[model samples]
Target: MFNYTMKDNCLAKKVILVTGAGSGIGRQAALTYAKLGATVILLGKTVQKLEQVYDEIIANGGAEPAIVPLDLKGATQQNYIDMSSTIAQQFGHLDGALLNASMLGELTPYTHIHQQIWDDTIKVNVTAQHLLSQALIPTMLKADNASLVFTSSGVGSKGRAYWGAYSVSKFATEGLMQVIADEYDESNLRVNAINPGATATAMRATAYPAEDQSTLATPEDIMPLYVYLMSDDSQNTTGQVIKAQ
Candidate 1:
């Protein structure tokens, strides 16, 4: 088990937003943030899953959360802009945003990569994130302090065979994090990337079906990095890729 000392007061009065909050790392992070005293905004395509997470947070006596049903794959810039505006109107300001929604297009030979799959993956995993961040930065700037975390992967830093569009998208995410971090270097906002190593999740299972599941850590196990990145404890840290295991 992980040792978590972040109390209900750690993120008191903070307003945080998490994409992909329907499941896996994003869901755990959302719950953890709520437990730490942050009012979380859960954004995902599936409203039912987000509702379950929201109910869990409230039932546990943590903060109540807001849910926004959005599919990153089909979301437009206007949609992201509207979301940012709505969040600003409701929360006054946003203190954190976790760009965790991503797609694994396919693991196939480079020559066999379908153009449609490649395009869709890049849009969901890269372009959508970029647009969302672009729209939200203004809202976040209104806060006293802000944090942005991008979900990255091992293949992002080191190219591996058959990783295809997923790898390319992650690499783009890392670069996006770096650029944003640099732009906000003098501001109260900090941006960083976290590589959740070989976690036991649906995404992991799909990517490596033959791997021994017992050997891998659960999504719950690597939350320390997620919490640290979101907390004031790591306020000065930015533009770095971190491994969570």
Candidate 2:
């Protein structure tokens, strides 16, 4: 696991956005950020799940959270722009953004990968991320130090059999992260990617149903890297693919 001791209220007064904030790693990260004193914006397709996280944050004595219901597959560039505008209007600046939403298309052989699955996977994991980053960069730069963290995978840099569009999309994600990081180098906004390794999440279960959940790390177990990247501890770090295990 990545080692970083987070102090209480490390993220005080910060405004962060988390995609896929409804469940699994995203949900845990949102709660953790809020607990550390950041106001989180939960963006996900499911409103009910967002509300549940919102309630949990409020009940835990964290800052009040905002929710943005969005399905990345069908979301347009304009949607992201408008959302960024709203964030600028409401919060004046964005301290961080965790682009964690991803779609795992069927694990079929390369030749057997369905067209629809490929399209949807790329749309959500690649295109949506591109648009969102473009829109959020301006708002993020408004802060003194802003971190843009993109979720990656073990296979993002190393290709594996049967991973299909999910793998390809992750490769694109890594590329996107590198591009943004290089562009914003020495600037207020820093960009990086994190590969959350073999966590016991619903997505992990879907990818490997027969795997023993008891042996895997929980979402909370891998949060040190998440908190480190978002907090001022890693203000000088950028353009790296960090593994959380």
lDDT of each: 0.92, 0.96
Q: Write candidate 1's Cα lDDT for 34-78 as tens digits.
A: 988999999999999999999999998987899999999888999
Model 2 per-residue lDDT tens digits across residues 22-42: 999999999999999999999
Q: Model 1 Cα displacement at 239 (Å)?
A: 0.7
TM-score of each: 0.97, 0.99
Error of 2 at 191 (Å): 0.2
Find the candidate with the highest lDDT and give its number.
Answer: 2
Which residue window of length 10 is worst by lDDT in model 2? 1-10
Model 1 scores a TM of 0.97
